[model samples]
Target: MDRDKEYRDACNQWLADCMLIYHNQVEKIRKKRLAAATEALTLCIKKQKKCVNETIKETIDFDTSYANKPSSVQMNVPKKVLEDLSFHSYIRMSATQLENLVSLTGPEMQKNNCFKKSIGVAQGLLLTLKFLAAGDSIYTVSCQYSIDCETIENIISTACKAIWNQLVLNVMPSDLSKNRWLKMAQEFEEKWDFPHCIGAIDAVHIVMQPSSNESPSKQKSNERNSIVLLAICDANFIFTFVDMGTYGCNGEIFRASQIGCAFENNDMNLPKPSPLNENDTENFPYVLVGDEAFPLKTYLLRPYPQKDCIEVSRLNFNCRLIRAQKTIETCLGILSSRWQIFSKTINMDVDKTMKIVQACVCLHNWLRLSDLSGNSCVRYMTTELVDQKVGDVFVAGSCRKSSERSGAFKDISCVGSNVGSRKAIQIRDSYLHYFNSNETLTRG
Candidate 1:
């Protein structure tokens, strides 16, 4: 009986000890998991703090000194010249304002070392604008600014890419509502007496350096050979669409046709047309006005042949076409004359050239917006025209008496009468006026 009791007590004690051991082991595991979790959380917090600190540092750095410094270690452009060239007028943004824009554009340019390093982002951007505005050779720009050609190229590429990808893409309003487009169409009708016109269409050549022998076959086409740029200008003279990559020597009519097809195929961002009917035909139909190079389709209108029996009618159509198409010429003229970079052959690869072109377009829009927002004098001028005398016989036959013209022309007579109810008469008068004005002036 005594041995049995002793053995039983020992077994109970052993069981108790094992249970305690097991509990201790479980507690130890719990502690280890807690420690590991705490360590992981602590490490994450440190990483987050480091990131916050770095961001704050960057913000502070940009806010304090980014705008005042030059883009490179050495200041290549003279301080005075840089100051003078800096857009500082009512039409130009201040340094701080430009810096904010740079900050907004910084992320897109972060991959570029030229943008990431020594130069102020604004200064780098300014250099590129100067290049575009002056149309100077890269070598000449380099010599004038005292920066290496490579650096100038880098700055221009980075700045242009970022501006195009960010500002132009985001800010350019694309609301092509029928009402808006129709309003533009109506403006053409009222101002230039162009019936059922949607917008004025024309192509301008932006000269580029000859393509390399190694250039891809697709890029070596006739239009791409010399770089012809096609653009459709709104009534306000703003370029709504620009298509490049055609050969320079390609006829404007051919290129305009391609663009029209592209618009039909939805290649360009043209708004879709609604169904057509006779009553709405004169108002709702979208049409493109071009010179003799383009065919006469219902959607596309061209001047009547000068040699046709309807010579007066042709003259009228041409005058209206010129009045509307003048916008494209004005836009191109401003681009080439105001921004020098476009007037001369561009040295960069085609891809870079495209970005630069886009950037300039965006910049032009920006300037226009700025100009409109304020009452600045010296708004950019339009294309010049010289007045000349038209043969009286041609004018007399083509121009109908105001009383003889149809009702539609009379209903819009208030606007048309200023020039004249007859299209041929208006054109002849404009030509005469152009010729008499200045010998150097060229018709738009």
Candidate 2:
């Protein structure tokens, strides 16, 4: 009985200790909760004070007069001053052409606000054009236009986007009809003396400055430091199609491969195959002539490799094909010369750079088709008709030989071996025969 009594007393003592420990834990939790609540309240009060101080400061410093004030600086190029300015010097367009562009893109580019006045559409258009034509940095352009650098950037972006969206449909159609392709083919035959040709395809390296955050390895690579602009131009210097923003590190062959995917996928509405000569019964598809950098496809013709020069016929075929391909090179030269922006390394965001280039192409097409066509800027464009009149055959051949030295020519033999079919070979041979027999080859 005494042992049982001692056990009961011990159990009671253990229970008492457990209750005391539980009470101590509850008190500690209460203190923690109080500290957390106090900290949160203090933070909330601090944020509210900051907000109130900011609001009060903004209200006190707000100047109503500044909102009403006009820009102290204005565009100095007035009508009389513009008259004195050369058409090519002022935005690389005739004044009449500039007016026409303004008419098309004005409504879309105009911005307005109730408190602060926005830039006028006319001023904005001029600013954008001068920026592109001058190839000036945003800060330099902003100073000339009497606007902030940020404002100039906004204007340029908006104007370029507007120009591309508004004019690309009319200038460069994605879905060309059968008649349109036929028209291009006829022009190629008549002007370039090349049959069954619709366009000349090529790519150019648009120089760009490497970003600060780019890796040292990437910056060191030439291709990584530039952009590739792939385009197809017609017998005229107008761009028929453009695919921009490809990485510079990629070769022209890579860009062409992307188009090949579209062609194979039946997404590209290519012209239907027809006769090489009007009298011939066997049909041949219209083809685009590109340099050796591109792979040989049934629809795209590249020259024979340097080692493949076994016969005069092979050499003649390369010459004629290069004659057709020269259109794209001339178009690129004219574009770069006119814009001046393309001649140097473009230091801007990739997207902005693309839009600017796209805008230039649209303007080129517009200028080619516009009534204001007497501008001297277009005289730089190479003309097949002029060369034909002078009986110049060696010019294209010489150009091809010179171009081969640029190291851009790829060994496309392996790639072409699989893709080029027997039928395409026959079509190329037929053209070679036509070129050899039609006219006596003469030196340029």
User: Which lDDT tens digits does candidate 2 get at residues 1-444?
Assistant: 999999999999999999999999999999999999999977974453343432232211111222223544444443322233454476766555666677787666654331125465666677777777767877788677577776676778888888998899989988887788899999998877788898998776665778789899978876666556677899976899887655423333343456656655766676788776656676778888888767667777888877987988789888888988988876766666556566466777677778888898887787776623565333323353223334644344223332231322122212223246786677676666666764524411
TM-score of 2: 0.70
Q: Report lDDT (Cα) of residue 7, candidate 2.
A: 100
Q: What TM-score do all the candidates reach, one by one?
A: 0.60, 0.70
Instruction: Give the C-alpha miss distance for residue 405 in model 2, angstroms.
Output: 14
- Show where candidate 2 strays beyond 4 Å: 1-73, 78-85, 112-118, 248-258, 371-419, 437-444
Measured with C-alpha atoms, the lDDT of residue 146 in candidate 2 is 72
Candidate 1 local lDDT, 123-194, one digit each (tens) = 666677667766667898677767778887888888888877776654355446667677877777665555
Please report the candidate that would top TM-score against the real structure.
Answer: 2
Clash counts for all predictions: 25, 1
